[model samples]
Target: MKYKVTQETELLNFLLEATSKKRNDLKKALKFNQVLVNGKSESYHAFLLHAGDEVELGKKSRQDLPFPILYEDKEIIVINKPSGLVSEQTMHNKSETAFMIVNGYLKKKKEKAYLVHRLDQDTSGVMMFVKNKKLYEELTHNWNDYVLERSYQAIVEGTIKKDGRIENYLSENKMQKVYVSNKKGKKAITNYHVLKNVKGYTLLDVFIETGRKNQIRVHMSSLGHPIAGDRKYGAQTNPIRRLALHANIFAFEHPFTHKTMTFKTEMPETFYKVTGKIKK
Candidate 1:
């Protein structure tokens, strides 16, 4: 059910006035991720509902969304996020992001979703979100316990002679530049295996046990081989025209079922094309 608000009011009060459902029932629906505000899931009952805002009482039909939904259930959702899109809204850019897009799709169904993690705007591939606040809080509070493995595929400059682990302490300066430090910050661990070598680049399978911001890019650059097209870290080439990194694989146990689940996406076709053109 959908209703367009005519007067400014609080969210809960608006729902009560629009529907005959009791306040408790409306609250239950909101907690279940059933209510939507302007194509997004909003749980704040007292949130002021602006006039003309669309309010959905139940899930609506979502179709032909921009992104692909890899997986979805009552508890969580997984999708293939494209490059050049931020995972969530930032202070500077209030434009559409993965979070807003997902909510837009959900809002069509009168449902809503929550972002559980984020991927850099230039990085593409698998990402996850939670449906309800309870599951969101549970998964966030014990992240590592629930997330079993997270891996990425990166095309980097130069050749990696052998597979190895890169462990270091990473710290960020005031300029937002992250670097490896000898005496500060928290430990970051990245294990990488060389899948193959192309022309002047290496195709690497990177598994990160620690989800540090810019961990993979920093670790690979610290090894003297920045990711291809990663001008921020020091890549000398622009074969792919963007950050040559992707979050390709994610494995985890269900927060509610405790069953192991894995999600994977094919590496961007352009990556293979560029690597193929590199002469050995």
Candidate 2:
């Protein structure tokens, strides 16, 4: 809906009268960039509106999104990325990446997206991207400092009797497979909590202190309980038909604003099915 301001007033006051929406709902709309003033998004409730200003409600929805957008703002965009799509383009494969899909979405607004981090091709759920170069550089350069939480949910092949932590050095080989290396490699630390065990499979809530290439997969494999469907990590089962690892929760501090931001996505229903648990 679009409204032309006939008198000077505050944005929230104008919205309350014009849209007849609850104040909290209108606040949420503004926070999510659903309100625009003369084409630019405005999130401030107290922003002054003058006569002749055009206010628009409702952001344009993208059609056929491979990954569902969880949140977006002027600085960053978050998505619940689906499995099977690579996070970003690589030299060998340049088509149909999450980055490409999001970039296309932003292009309509005359903006661009920059990759802040990546989730593996088969990993589904929360992924974030920066909108501009300055914020992108700020985030990438000090990622460890800004990132507060990185959590995943996985269904592994065996029944874990207890929760534990795995600490080791990991190195990737020429074939792009990660393995524990005692001699020389980057340190990787993973902590796992046993969520449940169903049949022969175990559901794990995995947290990583150090993000390395395939850290969770390697750590779980080291425990002799590789994530289900993770064939490369020595899993004997492919229950979900895809890697049973999902980056379900991600929280970080906004580099520029210094405010904590969090994004979460529901675990895939297939994960629950594989574990014989009802999705809630």
Q: Of the candidates shown, which would achieve the greatest lDDT relative to the real structure?
A: 2
- lDDT digits (tens) for residues 1-280 of candidate 1: 8899998998898888889999887875664346778887554566677878999877633545555578887677898776667888877678568898788877777778988888988788899988788888888889989988899989999988899998889999887789999857979999998888978889988999999889999999999999998888999997755688999999888888889989999776557665664334
Error of 2 at 238 (Å): 0.7
Q: Could you give the C-alpha RMSD of every candidate to the true structure, in order shown? A: 14.4, 14.1
Instruction: Estimate TM-scores for all models.
Output: 0.75, 0.76
**Stretches of candidate 1 above 4 Å error?**
1-62, 277-280
lDDT of 2 by residue, 1-280 (tens): 8999999998989999998789988976764456789987665577789999999987643544544688988888898876767888787777578888889988988999999889988888899998889988988888999999999999999889898999889999988899999859999999998888898999988999988988999989988999999999999988666799999999998877789998988776557666766444
**Which residue pairs show backbone clashes in model 1?**
59-109, 60-109, 60-110
lDDT of each: 0.82, 0.85
For candidate 1, report its TM-score: 0.75
Q: In model 2, which runs have C-alpha deviations exceeding 4 angstroms?
A: 1-64, 278-280
